[model samples]
Target: MDLGTCDDSGLETGSDAFLALRIRIETHIATIGIIGLGYVGLPLAQAIVERGYPVLGLDVDTTKVETLNRGETYIRHITAETVAAMGATGRFSATVDFDRLAECDLILICVPTPLNRYREPDLSYVEETTRAIAARLRRGQLIVLESTTYPGTTAQLMAPILEAGGLRSGSDFFLAYSPEREDPGNPQYSTAAIPKVVGGEGPEALELARLFYASIVAQAIPVSSSATAEAVKLTENIFRAVNIALVNELKVIYDAMGIDVWEVIDAAKTKPFGFMPFYPGPGLGGHCIPIDPFYLTWKAREFEINTRFIELAGEVNTRMPHWVVERLALALDQRLGRGLSRARVLLLGMAYKKNVGDLRESPSLRLMEMMEGRGAHVDYHDPYIPEVMRTREHPSLAGRRSIAWNLASIAEYDAVLIATDHDGLDYEGMVGAAKLVVDTRNVCARHGVSGANVVKA
Candidate 1:
């Protein structure tokens, strides 16, 4: 219990304390491994290596492994230089091998926690990865679940599978849940700057997990239990989902009242306190915000309690894509003297957000599919994403093509729908050229686009 420190002489001290201290020090210096080198994992691995920890990045994608091994980054926000530097220092490496999990003392799971067609939490990736980790489970190794999930996932689902390898939690090994708070394209917060929330099964597990995150992160917030930590992540996304639904609802109301929602928001934002702005868009996109909230809602149903706000928000946000199509149809009817059918509709951007190339759950795709379904000949233009895989929803659209930025050609489209507002997009030229514009984002309004040509949603 003394936990003795190393003396200047480096000799054995009080009782068996020196031996115990040596074991602890050895474990502290053990290798760190990260699974899934996407937006969440790559930054975390880089931050861990920057903290002078030997880190291994494991991904099922061979291309990702190849890219990382060559000191390159496939992700837009992550740079090749960082990977190169880490590789040069011999502290970081990536592989597709599952067997290498045995070499890592601390393993962080950052795999995708996507929802299935039924909107049920698809935890297959987490389960398979847990099985892989359990295969290599060793005494004293620490495992942290970084993937977002329902409240009891770490304890009820992952904990048992991890313990299957003849290891007991808090005794033979440590397990914790620290959801990844990755905000891609944010200039202010890097992986190291974000305060990590960690909670383990018990006191010993919690302290060890706290120490592990504290080695790299700015701060570690230790919660009561793993379920609380999981709930914290869900609460963050659910808050956004509900607030975004509020703004989306407001956008509908303001549009009906002939009041510019963006203008109203800009005016409201002038107040310093008691107000934080959440913009209305075509719909919710990206991996986290649109999906994580539903995981909690799904779990909440088992308690026979309804999550009205969460469901309402999801309903409102989901309807926006259809509403965007309606706006486009109306814009075309007024300008071209016809319905949306055979109207050459060109979508502005395909990526979920403004600048990033991530397209998971992108509402732009849904809008395009809905437009195509309504007999509008739809084409998309995203500089970041040149080709999009055809989904079951949009099977007729074989693939997507990037729209040429030429004013003459861009003007050919009957209506241009701005789904995403990328920074480099020529908003002025687009508004000037396009005969009819449906701006789901407030890009056209911000650029002072005139009436008769532009419509805001």
Candidate 2:
């Protein structure tokens, strides 16, 4: 176990293709290709470039590629200066060109793997990306899938597609699965600092994957197999989803009993032992919590087993938007003497989480859609999202632009619903101005705007 006694004896002997790929990796001269210049891939590319490794980014979106190539960042948290600095290093470039995929020595897939309408695993992005790699596959190159998916995805789906180039996987080429740990808008954690989990199908693939992530992150945790690595990511997300759902349900129960859930949580969290505080909201937000747990549920069905906790959590979380609107109806009627039918509701914060513009599966959108359906006029204000687009998932609420909020604008609304508590905003002013504030986030409670003016949903 001595650090000085560590050697390369763990790496298995393989073909010339494997040996040359290993040499390039160990020498730090290998070009890194990142498919998908997204929240995950962009940070990873920046980290590699900072480490003195040249990186090429490939994406299907021409606009994103052009923006990155122009040294501008479309994401809010990432600055243009950082991107321009990386571009100036002459080691970073983003493109829509798949033909240039052959130029890189190691490739990483960081695309989205969302669930379809039936709530099944829609791995279209991973499938399409692997096929593109298959077409351009060559010897002496290593590929890694960093997309979060179900177990056996790297070996069952990607390995065969990558082997279609007349090259056997783990022999002529290396393939591995390493889950991405990118937490957007978190100032404390970055891609370069977070620990990585790496696993592979063979000994050679495992060693290469472990070493590759070791260069990027603070520590690389090597698992027994590729499927276990994938499962580890799922377990991390499912824990959050279930715990959040429990708190959301308790928020409802505590309200019914005339006890403040926020105050209860404040008291419970003070113990600081065998307890972790998970706050309630209108619903679950972000790409991981609301969607990723279902991947395990779908995969578990193959063994004729049902994931009851995941299903129950999903049901409870999904009911939050409707329950929130129902509570808003009661609060609005009690304050203004009218139902939701002509209520002018203003929603605060549209992003799934605070301070990040990512709206994937954001429950605030569902709250807006529900309010609008009930004969209420809904408008939103998010410092992050300037305008909502017509995505295939939530196209009904498209083309809505964020309205600037102030004392005058706040008084005009019949009610204000605090969806996400983005910091640095004047919460005191909004709580003081709005007549009946239905706070789904507990921002008002913390700000001391209580009594007849605010109702904690």
Give the number of the best model, judged by lDDT: 2
Model 1 TM-score relative to the real fold? 0.93
Could you give candidate 2's per-residue lDDT for residues 271-292 as a string of tens digits? 9698899999999888788889
TM-score (C-alpha) between model 2 and the true structure: 0.97
Off by over 4 Å in 1: 1-28, 389-398
Assess every candidate by TM-score: 0.93, 0.97
In angstroms, the error of model 2 at 37 is: 0.8
Error of 2 at 360 (Å): 0.9
lDDT at 434 for candidate 2?
85
Lowest lDDT sum, 10 consecutive residues, model 1, at 12-21
Give the RMSD in angstroms, all C-alphas superposed, for model 1.
3.7
Collision pairs in model 1: none
Cα deviation of 331, candidate 2, in Å: 0.2
